[model samples]
Target: MQSTSHSAVLGRRKEPHTIIIARGDAVRHFTIRPWVATLLVCCVAVIAAGYLLATTYLVLRDDLIGASVAWQARMQQAYEDRIATLRSQIDRITSRQLLDQQLMEQKVNELIERQTALTERQNVIAPIVERVNTAPTGEESERIEKKPQLGTVSPDQSGFKASQIAALWKTRTESLNKTPAEKADLAFSTITKSLRHVEDDQLKRLESLADDAYQTADKISQALASAGLVIDVDYDKANVGGPLIEIDKSQVFDTRVRELNAAFRMLDTVKDQARSLPVANPAPGRPVSSSFGVRRDPIIGTAALHSGMDFRTGTGTPIRATASGTVVSAGWSGGYGRMVEVEHGQGFTTRYAHMSEILVVPGEKIERGMIVGKTGSSGRSTGPHLHYEVRKNGTALDPLRFITAGRQIQSYL
Candidate 1:
């Protein structure tokens, strides 16, 4: 049965089909085998499948390419954005660092200028302080135990020297994670504060010195008034001028200095006046035989006005000039025989009367304590004595007033 089925399949496959076609009187015949037909069908099917597959590929190619291009663009944009962000961050950091540096430099420069200004102020204040320290203060002299050495700012006191600031900066930078500019800024601020303190100290010193000078001048004035001598001091206007600059009231150092200088000038003027006044006793360590006023006349034995104080001393005792002056009259003058009159300036004069001998001639310049004559009872007197008279502009004044004032003012001088 298998052989029969196989023979049948083979016979069908070997069978040929014939087709005849006639056009007009001519005819044509064609024969086709089953195997050939099957082969042709296979070739047609293969060609159709290949065409369909090619068409499908052509339809999807554009979408695939578009997706791939989109993905690549996204990746490139992401990379670019990341790079831009990093660049911005780096720029910000760099800019911040530069700004910090500039600020630090500005602060440091300001500190340096302030320090220089303080140094200049010290220069002006040093001499003024020295003058105040050396000035006579009478009983208060003990209070001024020592004079400070000026013109140098102690770093330990102020804590603002350049080297110290640098050291501080280094120490802070090592301890902190801060940048160099930040550390520098901190150091500069510290220095500025210290310099401000120094400035304040200088101002205070100047103020104190100025007050002392003015007080000294006032004391001299008061002392002169006590002696019944009112002296006027005129201070010359200082030739000071400068370019206009805005200054606050707190910065009055220059004003203080000017005031101190004026005080010194006034003190000098008063001192000169005091020196010219007759204030010393002509015969020191001698007893006063007769007081200045109405007294009994030794020779006449009656009450009379005694124009001067009489000092009892042996004849030929040395008599000294009470003040520096010129010998205006050194010759005999009737009752004031062998008299020596000294003309001290400021309308003051001294007369040494009843002298046994005149040591200075008229028109001779003499200083205080100079031996101007010898004591004797040469003018309407009955004993060896010296008559000392203090006159102001030809008018007699109490000699005791000047003598007392001199004693009080001696310490100041």
Candidate 2:
């Protein structure tokens, strides 16, 4: 009986440990009563295995994350480098100084504005590419350049065709992450093709515009040349490349037009001014000492504003009308011996003071620069000098301002 019981105990122990892994009751329902304590030991082994598996996965996850971050950083750096290069190129092109100073500045301003627009475009497009690599396959990227059915391609033809030339060569951006690898390749290739197309179109247009500009400039320049205006055909130094690409003739001709107009304006202004006034010199040898306004007062103390310029001409120098007008007054006036006043319209008048002799009577019409009398020390009696005065609305104006170059005033004594 003892041997049989011992054998039974061994057999019971040998049976697979029945550790209750399922629950049946509210409490520890299926209580795992270790037949021989082996059942409890089995539970511990399973827990240990699970802990080891979880730890391994955590370590792997950290390493994968590190690599992904590194990739993203590198991509960002590359993109930045490209943007910087483009900006540099744009800057160089915009700073040209060869054209007309004013026009060049305007063009540079325009170029800077366009470059800013292009930069904004790049900023909008760059992030979309990065997100594509992280988006799941079959994902629709929010950044994809979906074109409206504005072209010849039908809706069915418009759908993405990884193998089609047009689809693979254009509309190549994606907004999703975890996208299929093939799509990325396709997107990049298409983008490259698209960029080349754009660059080519722009280059051709630039060339065409430049050609057109040259033709227009040349034509207008010929016209200006015939019209006696010279064109300045030059490019700015700061602008890159061999020449400026453009299509505007007014760019050059306008400058010449402005210059010509300015020159004519100056001539017109000069002609409008009265320079030589009429007066006679009583003394023949004394040159004009002082013309008008404050002098040494011939006897004052402080520096005073000289109202008119002086003409150092020999006495008896003949004086004439500075302009054509009617003599409004001819008589002796205080500090003015036998003076004559002439009125030139628009509220302007000329006065010849201290005249040795008044040749023209009051109300007499006189020609410009006409000899009016001899220079004399008749009034205020200083040596002979015509105290000629120009007045606009009765206010004394400068006589020198009207004096024409190379023409001396007077014919007296």
Candidate 3:
């Protein structure tokens, strides 16, 4: 009996528990031991915890993705802004470079214009200078030539120098700064200064030339005065008026040009007057036999006033008028046979007497060196000789003096 009771207790302890449920007219039953039930509860807890962990992992992954996308967008925007700023800077630099180029072009054009003006002025003045250098003033010719040593700076050379300076300035400006505006300003300033210097040099050269011309004209005037000739210039009637225009700021150049013109005009007037003077030799290459003044008369053999010079020439030798004039007498006169008288203007007259024949008529115009008569001893002479007389307002004067003055003036011409 005791063995039987212990077996039953062991069986009961190992026996599986049974559970039943009934709902909605359906019934179900399940039986499990303590170890199986514990396993089932553990499985349900593990499955629930897996579901919660999966949900949390999905939410966290989406949040991390959003944050990463937003960070990437910010980085892209920053890069674009940086690029735009760089482009703006480049544009500003380009515009400045263009402006600098334009300014350089303008400066070059101005330099060209100045060179042209200077060249024109030089051309106009060169001939006047040459005339001055060539003028002859008897003993003073040598001194006048040596008076003014005019040194001229060629306009071409000046322009070339200016170009060189501009090139050097450009090179230096380029080296100074990276900014285009600064470089342009520096170049402009340098060119302006160089141009001013060139202008000053040109002005000085022109003024010197003008001074030389004035001096030459003055010397010529003095020579004329010494020869008893005067140039009558009417300043009030010069007709120099003109409409007022913009005066050149370079006054020196304009003033020099005007002075040169005036000097040249004066020289021309003097030359013309000298040409019209009755001072030519009447008998060229002929020896004088008798001088004018109180001398022994060849015919009378007595001291008497020899009012004319005598040239010993054979008959039929050509006699020429000493000056251009109108013939007033072309026939024989008392003590003169076949005589010809010419009335030159300016209170001057010439007479040729003792001629073989008269080739000119009374009231006829005669030119200098024209055939007026032939040389012969027709009246008041002892042999074949010709008499020439020069008178100033009907007063007899020495023809030799007038001939000498003519020679001197001719040298200048």
**TM value for model 2:** 0.30
Which residue window of length 10 is worst by lDDT in model 1? 143-152
Best candidate according to TM-score: 1
Any runs in candidate 3 off by more than 4 Å, and if so which?
Answer: 1-85, 115-224, 230-254
- Write candidate 3's Cα lDDT for 129-183 as tens digits: 5765665566446654544423343556455575499887788776676565566
TM-score, per-candidate, Cα-based: 0.62, 0.30, 0.62
Model 1 over residues 1-413: C-alpha lDDT tens digits?
A: 98889887776444578888999998998897788889999999999999998898899889889999999999999999999999999999999878877876777778778777777777777776667567646743654444323443454556567778888778776748766666666667667766776676666555655565556556766777897977665454356667998777555767766776776677777777767778777898898888878887887789998888889999999998888899998989999888999999878899999999999999999987899989998877788899899998898887777777776776666
In model 2, how large is the Cα lDDT of residue 62?
85
Off by over 4 Å in 2: 1-288, 291-293, 299-315, 404-413
lDDT of 2 by residue, 1-413 (tens): 98889888776444443444545664333434455467657778888888888988897988889899999999999999999999988777655323334554564565565456445534432342333224422212321234211112334444545567665445443334434545544544554554444333333333433343344334433433442324343322135567667746334333333343343333233333322222222223335566556556664556665555444443566667767789899889986776888887767777877677788998898876577776666776556667777677887765544442112211110
Q: What is the lDDT of residue 247 in candidate 1?
A: 74
Ranking by lDDT: 1, 3, 2
Highest lDDT among the candidates is held by which one? 1
Q: What lDDT score belongs to each candidate, Candidate 1 first?
A: 0.78, 0.52, 0.73
